[model samples]
Target: MKLKPTIFVFAIWATGLCHAYASTSHEIECPTEISAAALAINAPEGWSAYAQEGLRLRSAEPALGPPEEKAFLKPGSTKSIKGGSIDSWLELSGSGPTGKWIVCRYGERGEITLSKKLHDNTSACTVSSRREQVQVSCTW
Candidate 1:
């Protein structure tokens, strides 16, 4: 019984240590530029523009969490993400016509792009355009 308590304490300590390591200054070589556009440009038929109040792009990799920079997309406008760095995933969230939704996409590191498509049960986010830097356009 005493041994069990000791083991449990060790486990907690180990978990904390892992979290600490994840937040340390670990350099991850990745693209430093990003851009996000919120519009109905390439949205599917019947789909319309909706405000993405909580649009954000951030690192999905645990080790890159702290160094994980984020870019926010305006609620109902199109603009470039000036200073943000992300690795692994891009998150898009907000209330749409149907309801509230949050979407995640695995990023393409080599190509410096997000996965081709983003969708929920009733709506989808498509890549409207891509240019000099990593540009993303979504409609829902």
Candidate 2:
């Protein structure tokens, strides 16, 4: 998929492209605890794992070929394979189910540590953003 950069124009003063605002950084967080099963059931069809956290769907059978690349639009997402580098995407390992799943490492300095898998029974989640921070709040 082609990525498009979002540019914000503030003012123009007859000096070419005057002022443009672009967000350089982003933060991904799910304030309310959630579970893999709950995520699989609750998340929308095209939900981003980066935005939802641990919401991966896998088939009972193994994948036929190599893993695919999953892009996370938000910040703090890591690169594929040896996922230490911070990026907006990840290379998912194995074959996911009908839905999309991004499996990559991102635990490094400045990255938020994911909480242990637990049960929450959350049926819906609301995502909000302010500046660079992305918040995901869930409810039953």
Candidate 3:
């Protein structure tokens, strides 16, 4: 199989549903905590893994013997991958206000780190938090 460079676009909508766009790609939804494992096991054969921070997929069988180069994910940005086009998105939320971040990347043997920090806001009577680093990895 041949790999095409494609962009994965994710947008947060008002209803809390994530909107995603990619060229000739299919969408897969996984549980918030197990997204990394799900993507790895569910990826089609002959397609490698690609993910952003906090997300990851296992390596896929390459059409050729080995892959040319590895890919990495950028925080608050998108990355493209080779081989089969399998794209996915995950969301998590509780009762109060919510925020969402999306990252996209492609290639093999790639990794990223994700973290979170929480802050209390007395003025707004709300608790604010930010994800520090989210890790993602892929190999072929």
Best by lDDT: 1
lDDT of 3 by residue, 22-127 (tens): 1122222211342544444455899867644334423221111112222222122233434323322211222223212122222234343222211211111111
lDDT of each: 0.34, 0.29, 0.26
Ranking by TM-score: 2, 1, 3
Locate the minimum summed-lDDT window of 10 residues in model 1: 59-68
Residue 128 lDDT in model 3?
Answer: 12
TM-score of 3: 0.16
- Scanning candidate 2 in windows of ten residues, the lowest lDDT window is 57-66
| Candidate 1 residue 60 C-alpha distance from true site, Å | 21
User: What would the TM-score be for candidate 2 when compared with the true structure?
Assistant: 0.21
lDDT of 2 by residue, 10-53 (tens): 22332344323221222224333334444434557887553445
Query: Each candidate's TM vs. the true structure?
Result: 0.20, 0.21, 0.16
User: Which whole-number lDDT from 0 to 100 does residue 118 have in model 3?
Assistant: 16
Clashes of each: 0, 0, 16
lDDT of 1 by residue, 11-57 (tens): 99999998764422222222333334432247689887554442333
Give the number of colliding residue pairs in candidate 3: 16
